[model samples]
Target: MRQTIESRQAELNAARLRMLNKKQEAGDRRQEAGDRRREAGGRGRWTEIA
Candidate 1:
């Protein structure tokens, strides 16, 4: 019984780790897009202001 519980806990931990990794990847992608917009002289920001 204890072994079953430990295995289930391990699986949950792995799932949580995967979710964190996916979130990190999404954040990195967003950061890269922001960097590109900045490199383009803030054209996107200007449009938002207008």
Candidate 2:
């Protein structure tokens, strides 16, 4: 009975780790997209001035 409980707890912990990893990945993607937008905007301003 105790072993079963331990196994279940381990599974839950693994799932929680996976969820955290996914959240981190999503945040990194959002940051990358923002960087791309900023780069594009900077280029547009340069083109207009030239």
Candidate 3:
């Protein structure tokens, strides 16, 4: 029983790491896109109007 619980915990940790990596990758892509937009011009649909 203890071994089963430990294995389950390991699986959960591995899944959590995978999710975290995916989020990081998405964030990096977003940042890169934002940089490209800024380089092209200061015009983006999501730009806030102040």
TM-score of each: 0.84, 0.76, 0.81
lDDT of each residue in 3-33, candidate 3, tens digit only:
9999999999999999999999999998887
Q: Which segments of model 1 are wrong by more than 4 Å?
A: 44-50
* Per-residue C-alpha lDDT of model 1 across residues 16-47, encoded as one tens digit per residue: 99999999999999777777777778865432
How close to the true structure is residue 13 of candidate 3, measured as C-alpha lDDT? 100
| Residue 26 Cα positional deviation in candidate 1, in Å, after optimal superposition | 0.3
Question: Per-candidate RMSD vs. true structure?
Answer: 3.1, 6.6, 2.6
Look at candidate 3 and tell me the lDDT of residue 31.
Answer: 88
Off by over 4 Å in 2: 42-50
CA error at residue 1 for candidate 2, angstroms: 0.7
Question: What are the Cα lDDT values of the candidates?
Answer: 0.82, 0.82, 0.85
- Winner on TM-score (1 vs 2): 1
For model 2, give the RMSD to the true fold.
6.6
> Of the pair 1 and 3, which is ahead by lDDT?
3
| Model 1 global lDDT (CA atoms, 0 to 1) | 0.82
